[model samples]
Target: MTDIFGVVADATRRELLQVLLERYLAPESATGDISVGELVEKLGLSQPTVSKHLKVLRDSGLVAVREVGQHRYYRLEPGPLDVVEEWLVPFLSVDSLGGGLEQGEASGAFAAWSGVQMPASLRRAGESLQHPSDAGAAVGRAMADATHGTRHRFEEASEAVERKVFDPIRKKLKKD
Candidate 1:
């Protein structure tokens, strides 16, 4: 089996994965699974070329396949990508800007939503990004901007749910 690094090293493979995601995983118009022909058309590659990339992705367990008659349908397998995310947490921290975060909260909060625990070393790495100095001001401002944006979106989504879902039920119960 090829390692994920090797499988994703090729730009074509990444593009293939994007094609599968955009076509089959789009929440607005997802059709569930995608076939090799569709990938070839979207990727503008030959069947053999597309199939070769799919084989590598399948071997690395990055893509799951369903056999239906003679056609094979492929979908993304997200489990293996968590390893890549773990490796990336340190880099994603504000280490370069000299201020990371407190208590690995960034990765911890993100991972909590995904139901995965952040590793200890990675958590420490995130905490180590916290630096209190003049230079850290820039990083803090950036973090604040991102946090505000995320919080605003979450609040908006919560309000929408309350209005469109819970409010109607509340009104019905009151009527009853």
Candidate 2:
């Protein structure tokens, strides 16, 4: 499946995708949608210029456009992008990457929401991110993992991200 990310490997398209994603993901976005005028204003691009990028995203099936009378509203469709996300899961996943934030809380606020008491080890580590001296060591300890089982899976995932997504973007961008 083609994704906005594929087309958005272009800097211009990335800007448009950022606007759409931010607007769509925002809690107060207009109807959870954005109009072409709003996109132009937010991105500081011309209507036709923004429309051109929108067309690319729409054609790639990464975005959907709905027409209400004369205005068109665009929204992100995660299906095509899921291919990219899934492909990059290894490099981005906490389980695979080994040093990233925990599941469900990208900022690592698992204690409050998970109803699981923060382990003293992690609490100390989290507190350490606040201190300049212990920050580096704290981060290292927070990310330590026993490399018993998941190495091969992460290797395969890393390879996929390099081959399928990163390499393609690099090759495409390097073309004359």
Candidate 3:
């Protein structure tokens, strides 16, 4: 789906998107909302100019607005971001390269061509960090885990429901 973000990739629209994202990330007031005046001050753009950018942003689904009394507050909408992420998957996948990357070659001829660069120590650290089960691996473990359906370190969920509910309380009580 061609989204507002596709339209928003333009320089002016992107600047507006960045401003909106920043506001959502760090809200200024009780409602954490921003008005056209606030955006004008923050971006140093005129009211109508900011409004024009905002209109494009709003039309593209990159932003959402709410009316409170006489004010209109704008914030980012993350739903379209998911679609963009999915669309980017093929570009992110290494399997598409086929036949796997050859060793030594991974750093020399191939690396030179692909613009890959890394310090020796950093490369060693990365090598040491490889999953034991996947000997000779160099890609990120999170991507490996995802491809293999292995549970990610941060994504662990307790099989025991009661324990899941009580563990946090237990920690708090113990602390008390």
Among these predicted structures, which one has the highest lDDT?
A: 1
lDDT for each residue of candidate 3 in 1-176, tens digit (9 for 90 to 100): 34645665778777777767656654344544678788888778899988888887777677788988888888877677766655444334323233333343343233556766533433555677647655345445534533343232213443353357545755785899
Q: Write the per-residue lDDT of candidate 1 for residues 75-102, one digit (tens) a residue.
A: 8886787777556543354232224444
Model 1 alpha-carbon drift over 4 Å, by segment: 28-31, 96-176
- Cα TM-score of candidate 2: 0.50
Descending-lDDT candidate ranking: 1, 2, 3
* TM-score winner between candidates 1 and 2: 1
The pairs that clash in candidate 2 are none
lDDT of each: 0.70, 0.67, 0.60
Which candidate has the highest TM-score of all? 1
lDDT: worst 10-residue window of model 3? 150-159
